[model samples]
Structures are given as structure tokens and as C-alpha cells.
Target: MGGVNCLRSLVVLAIVCLMTLFVAQRHKGLTFYKIDAPVLIAHGGGGLPEATTSNSLEALQRSKAVGFCLIEVDFDLSNDEVQLDRKMKDGSPILRDDLSNLTPMTLADLVAWMAKNPTIRIVTDTKDSNEKLIARLSQTGLKEQLIVQVYQADQYQIARNAGFDTIILTLYQSTMSDDEILEFAKANRPFAVTIPRKRATNGNLPERLHEEGVQVLINTINDVWEGKAFLKRGISGFYSDTLMPKGTSSC
Candidate 1:
């Protein structure tokens, strides 16, 4: 009788554990594992001295060569055309070192590259027109390879509905208070939330988000030790210009 009771207790415990996992999975957006996994996302294809141009194809190649699987690209909408340009200070994203001329990549160019490199996933960032961009990328049939970053809380569902199962809610552009942000995160539960490095260091948002089963990523981290410190404070990953994972070297 004692043995039978012990077996029953084990079975009950297993059932509870499975239920907890199911709830957590349901709360997270689609492709939970993809976003929740701790990864070093190369910012602007990484910061190699020769290939430091932001969002350039050459930089992307260098980052890939360094064994980075996740890469972030910034896009801007101009005249109804999507182009890769993080900052348009000189009306040009970057000047080509080889050509000594300003050249930027188009959406079509990125799509073609993504088709060829199926293993590398892209994280998209834009100040505006995020839904439009998400819709456009979804139409390319590479939804699985794209991770959409929405600046607004309401844009979360819009992105998810656009066939982008993996969506990250980036908070840099938001005006919501920390409590409001936490409330929305608890309600909608995006795959992850990326905060500025200042926010991650100065507040308890990272720990609070982690408690809600939401992964947190900090941006523009260039130092590995800084990344390590945030990881200890509940940050799951970082968007870094040059910080690569252990065993990976940047060229």
C-alpha cells in the first residue's frame, strides 16, 4: 500500500509540472523556444573594423563568419520603399569602403540573402511603419526566419497576425511607465522585450519581466563583462555590436 501511494504521488507531481509548462508556453507568443533561448544577436552585423558599416551585407557576412546565428538589421521606409538604414545622418547609411560611394541594401536584397542563408535569423528594427514592414516580410514566405520588433505594445498582436510568430517588443520608443509596461507584458506576453542598457541597469524591470516568464534582451552592449552582469540581473541576452558568444571570434 505504501509503494502504491508513493507511485501515485509521483504521478500527481508529474501532472502538475506538465500543466505549469503548458501555461507558460501558452503565455509566450509563437516560437517560444526560439525567442526565449539566450543568444548573442549581432547588432548591425557586428563591429569588425573592416566591416563596421551598419546593416551592410559585408558586415553581415563577417558576423556570420564569426558564428553568429542571430543578426539584427535596421530598416527605414522612404518613398514607400524599404531600405536598410539605421541612421540617415548624411542621407546615406554608409559609404562603401571598396567603392568609396554611398550604397544601401534594399528589402529585396535582404530577402534574397535570407533565402540563401536559412539558418541565420534576422531581427528587424524600425522607428515607424513596423506593421507595414511586418506585412511585407510576411509576404516573402520567410516568416520563419524573421523576428519582428514592435515599438508599441498594441503592435504585438498586429505583428503576430502578420505570420511573424517570433515577435520582440522593444521598449526604447515607448512612453509607458514601468508598471504599465509590466501590466501589458503580463497580459499579452510577447516573445521577448528588449530594453535600453540604461533601463536594464537602473531599474528592476528585467527581474520583474523574468518573473512573468518574459525573456529580456538589452541593446547595444559592446562589453562581454557588461553583458555578463546583466545576465546575472535577469537579462536573457543582448543586442551587441561586437560581443560574440564564447568560442566565437569577430573578424
Candidate 2:
């Protein structure tokens, strides 16, 4: 009986060591992306008030000031030449889809701003071709700070081929099975995947993704209760309008 008990203890110790090795390997795989988990990414630069509308320079600045290190901004081409958020009634360029007092900023403008604010990273929400977008960004020498959000597998490949180190495949409109999504992540090896908060809670998607060391980021979380709920569900981070209410802790 004494011998048997000693053998059982040895087995348990071996199993614990193996589990620790596995976890360390998984963490090393994620280290290539260089992102801190449970991050707060501002949606359209925090989607702040009229003085700092979405996708505007003011919005980006305000987001950084309020303790956000990552900001998502929209990008689209104007006449297939210049990159602008949208065009107004008079065909004047603007930073957001809705017309506002904030002036439109081109890709160059944003990159130059980022050069001055190196601590901030920008997530490019672009439906246009990655080749064109990358070409434009490369001119500014700030492409390393970009995280491209793509919809299609081909776009993911394009971003990778264009030498982007960080890429996210958005699953907001995906109807694929959980297995399919896992396979897609396995093949593409994106830095993260973004899904609507509703779908993020429905299945075992988050757990499966976590097992593979891929981070799961949910979109459009504006309140603290919902943010905490998702974080409790093992979500890696959020695309949020506000980081969290003042004096509130995300942990």
C-alpha cells in the first residue's frame, strides 16, 4: 500500500510538469504578436462626442489620452486614389461616415500623427484591397504600427504577403460552424479574431480559440457590465467606445 501511494504521487507530479510545459509553449506562440491580452481597442477612435467624431484626428488623440493604446479607424478610397472616410453632400472629404465639423484625414495624415504618438497602434478597418492599402501605408514608414482587420481569407493572405505582422479576421457576419472557424484560425494564424458580443456568448468558440493560443476580441462593448461579463467568459479583449467608466477596474 505504501509503494502504490508513492507511485501515484510520482504520476501526479509528472502530469503537472507536462501541463506546465504545454502552457509555456502556447504562451510562446502568442508572443510573436507582441500584444498584451485583455486589451481595450477603441472603436472608431472611441466614437467620442461631436468635438471628436469617429475616425478623426481629434478622436484618435482623445482615445490615447483616455488610457487606450489601440484605436480602430475606417479606411476607404476616394475615386480609387485618395483614402478618406467618406464624402459629404458637397463632395468634401470627412473622417467619418456622418458629416461633422471635424476635418477629414488621409492615411498619410494619420500615419504622420502616429509617428508623433508612437505608443498608440491603429487597427485598419478596410474593405478595400490590402495591396493598395499597404502601399499607401508603406509610404509613411509607420506600417509596423498597423493591425489590419480583414473579412475574407484572401484578404488575410494579402495582408500577410504585404508583410503585415499583425492581422485580425473579423467574424461579425460569419455563419461558419465553430469547427470551421477553428480551422480558419489554424490555417490563417491571425493575431486575433473579432466577433459580435452576442455571438461570442452563444457557443464554445472562445474556449476553443483560447486553447489554440488565438485571442478573441468582441466588438462594440460600451458599458462596464457587458464588458466584465464578456471578460469573465474568457474573452481576450474588446472593441469598446469607452475603456471603462472612471474609477472602475477592468480586472
Candidate 3:
């Protein structure tokens, strides 16, 4: 009789374990990138050595040769119009770009370029991405490759409402506490968080983010050691612009 009772208890334990696994998977929403190590995401248009990048054919060739799988670029709306307005550190504005020029790009033009480059994925910053522009992008061939990112929570809601399943955004610098960040990350369950390396708060913060189903990607890492440090702290990836590190390789 005791043996039969033990077998029944074992069956109950197994059922509980499977249920726990199901809940864990539902909560974690973290999709493994299948990409290991830190990914080198090209900043700007990967263009000229000067201030503003080319965003031209040259940028595409350069990034591909360097083995960069991700390209991060700016996409803004005019606020008054659906036309794009982007700003680069070089002081060039996308609005100022000539319609026939190759130096800069507009959002509509950006989508056209993405369709041309099917090999690389893009993380587009929607600083001013508006309803009309987003609707247009949703109809583009490159919509699947774009990650709609915004710093504002309202924008997050907008993207979600627009049927964007993946979002790359950051915690507010001023008001977000670690506890709150963790709760929000898990609750909303974005694909990833793109934040400056300096703003990660601490090692624990990233782990918490991960626990909440958000992968932390530290941005603008040119130094190799800093990249390694983030890796040690459990960050999923980083935004880098240099060549491969002397030692380690892919994740």
C-alpha cells in the first residue's frame, strides 16, 4: 500500500513540475538571439569618418565586411508632418538632405534602403515616429526586420497598439528605480532594452532585467574590457562600432 502511495505522490510531483515550467516560460518571454557574445551593431549610417555618416552604399559595404549583423539608425517625424527629421552629431539634419542626395536619409528612404539590404537587421529609433509614418512602414517589405524603439512609455503603447511585438527601449533615467524597472520589464515584457553603458545602474540591475524577460544591451561600447565586464554581469549584448576584439569571439 505504501509503495502505491509513493508512486501516486511521484505522479503529483511531476505534474506540479510541468506546470511550473509552463508558467516560467510564460513569464520569461526572453527569446534567445541564438547569437552569443556581444553583437557589433553599427551606429549611424556606417558611412564616412567625419561627423555624419554616409548611410549610402558605402555604409552598407563597410558594415557587412566588418561582420556587423545589426544597424542602429535614427528615424524621426517632423512633428508637424509625416516627413522625417533626424539629427546627427555632425550637425547634419535629415530634413536638410536633398531629395536626390545619398548623404542622409528620410524615414521613407530608410525603409527603401532596408529592403535593399536584406542581410542585416535594424534597430530604428523612433524619436519622432508618428502614426502615418509607422503605418507606412508597417506596409513595407522591411517591416519585419525593424525593431521599433522609443524612450517614451506612450510610444511603447503606440507601438504595441500598432501590433509591434518587439520593442527596444530604456528605463527612464530620472524616475525609474530598480524595483520598478524590474516590475515594468517583466510586466510589459519587451524583447530587449537598449541603454547607455553608463546608465545600467549596476550589475544587479541587469540581472533583474533579465529575470523580468528583458535582455539588456549596453550601447556605445568601443573598449573591449568594458564589453567583457558587461558580459560577466550577464548582459545579453552591446552596441559596438569597432573591429573584433583581439581575444574572444561570438556569443
| Tens-place lDDT digits, model 1, residues 39-74 | 778886555553443687776776787677888988
Give the candidate order by descending lDDT.
Answer: 1, 2, 3
Error of 3 at 42 (Å): 1.6
Model 2 lDDT per residue over 70-106, tens place? 8888777656654546644454555444435565676
Best by lDDT: 1
Model 2 ranges off by over 4 Å? 1-37, 51-53, 88-92, 95-99, 173-175, 244-251
Q: Identify the leading candidate in terms of TM-score.
A: 1
Measure candidate 3: CA RMSD.
19.9
User: What lDDT would candidate 1 get against the real structure?
Assistant: 0.76
TM-score, candidate number 2: 0.74
Summarize candidate 3's per-residue lDDT along 62-163 as a digit string, tens digits: 566556667766555543433233444344444344322444555556667767667667776444434555565666656668777656555677777776
* Candidate 3 structure lDDT: 0.60
Clashing pairs in 2: none
Residue pairs with colliding backbones in model 1 are: none
Question: What's the lDDT for candidate 2?
Answer: 0.71
Two-way TM-score contest, 1 vs 3, winner: 1
